[model samples]
Target: MQAPQREEIHLNVPSYKKNRSGIAKFVVLPELIKSLLSLAHGNADVECGFSENAALITDDRSSLSDISINGLRATKDAVKFYGQGKVHKVPICKGLLDNVKEAHSRYQVDQEITQRILEKKEAIVAAAKLTKHKELVLVGKEQNLIGQRKILQEDLENVSKMLNEGNSRLEATVATKNFAGVEMAQLLIGGAKKKLDVLKTQLGDNSDQMNQLKKN
Candidate 1:
């Protein structure tokens, strides 16, 4: 019996901020959300099993369903955090979770297609064997079967290669997005602090002016 395959799940988070203004609200801006989403998509691709066997199973194909579920949860959490107006660090984390879900869905579809093609090749090879014909015909048919198998193998190889490339791309994209989000958040927070400082200074100056006017 074929051993039941084991799957490993991995998650990556990057350090990016929304901007350098140093305000918490500005840190979680829409741009930060966008970046987070992009990163999440990439991470999803990486963590989901992109193997040939994975392609055979319809449910878990690209592992997109898993990523989607996780992504939805993260999005929900992020929405809640933002609702509280507390400027919590959890929303960005949630965004990353959501990205995984999207990636899984995509992988599943690709696997299904590859599996179908392989199955068809197998069927053709089986049918070719039962035919009784002249030696030349048999040789020709066998050659054709061999060629078909090679083509299928090549397709499988291409799919594997593409998955690897995608995984690498997702890893980089997530890293970049994380960096951008963190940076932007810090920038916005800074801006808010500076604004408060300016306000305090103006208020102090006004108080001094009023006192001098009263004395005069």
Candidate 2:
């Protein structure tokens, strides 16, 4: 069997446009130049030339692949060299370009993942700080409750002692015939005992609620 013959293809070479001073030619790809010119000048008749190898792929596909490959290589070089800011101008071969594009996409995904992790860390820190502040406020409220409980206990003890003394006085006065002094002492002692009981109940309820909040 005969090997397939390699075909020779002819292409018209397009001249690069030089500035009026002729110091340097614009370093853009030919396809980009054609597109810009067509867009700017409204599709004037312009001739473009390419070799058979260049024309093997459609212009759009070739240009897109070239740009993607170039961008990938640039990114790779930048990372490898630690932000050296130099784009390695490597030629875009088909297989190499595909691999580079895939790597670049993965790199982008990795960057997004890293960013999300950092944001989550920041959010966690903020939440922790808020929790700490709330704990501090709870501590202050707990201290206040303890103080109130102590005061209520002291008041209850004083009222109980007075009530006992008042009963003793009533008994003695009943025997000694001092009715006015006994009645006055009984009224004052009873009111103080009732107030002290109410305070104790309120303090007990407050303590329970505070404990529940701390558990939560």
Candidate 3:
């Protein structure tokens, strides 16, 4: 049977309804016409190609990538259509020879691009890791400095208390007219004052270090 052209069907379909009493009277004919019109003509070659593509992907060849599968399909189709179903029967053209010669160069360029992208990713990751490490080090330093400051403040307070106690004892000794007790009290006060000065200086140095860490 011969199929009608799309233009002929488009012009003649409305006539079927006009000739009949109503659309319901010509229901099956309209449906048949619609089905025939909807079919994509000249698609047999494409459908055949899809079937051939599916046949190529066996269990052993399931890992083939889209590019590899496409290349294989093209080669097979070329062999069957142009080469008369044999690889050696294919004609050696200048274009084919040129593409063959340039394949290595193209592959090398692709490799360089891929390697550069990978290296850039690695460098970014390394930089992030270094920054994190530095941040952790700064945190540790800050905590250490804070702890040292606390210890220093405590020592300064204890030394100040000792100095005050020594001065009170010296006053008591002097009031009692005891020369030896006053001399001992003066030595104790001097030692406590020196320790208080050292603790103050250490605390100041710790504060400076903490400030520097913050700036970094």
Question: Which candidate leads in TM-score?
Answer: 3
Question: For each candidate, C-alpha RMSD in Å?
Answer: 46.0, 17.8, 8.1
lDDT per prediction?
Answer: 0.54, 0.68, 0.85
> Which stretches of candidate 3 lie above 4 Å from their native place?
1-94
Error of 2 at 24 (Å): 75
Worst lDDT run of 10 residues, candidate 2, spans 5-14
TM per candidate comes to 0.21, 0.50, 0.62
Q: What are the clashing pairs of model 3?
A: none
lDDT of 3 by residue, 115-204 (tens): 999999999999999999998998999889888888888888899999999999999998998888988899989999899888888888
lDDT, candidate 1, 122-161, per-residue tens: 9888777645444466566556655655664565455455
Tell me the lDDT of model 3 at 190: 96
Mark the regions of model 1 whose C-alpha exceeds 4 Å error after superposition: 1-133, 178-216
lDDT of 2 by residue, 1-216 (tens): 674432211112133556788743545555564565456443233222233234445657665455455565555655556535544544446976788679879879867997999999999999999999998988888888788878878887887787887778878888889787787778867877787779778878878977886786
What clash count goes with each model?
46, 0, 0
Preferred candidate (TM-score higher): 1 or 3: 3
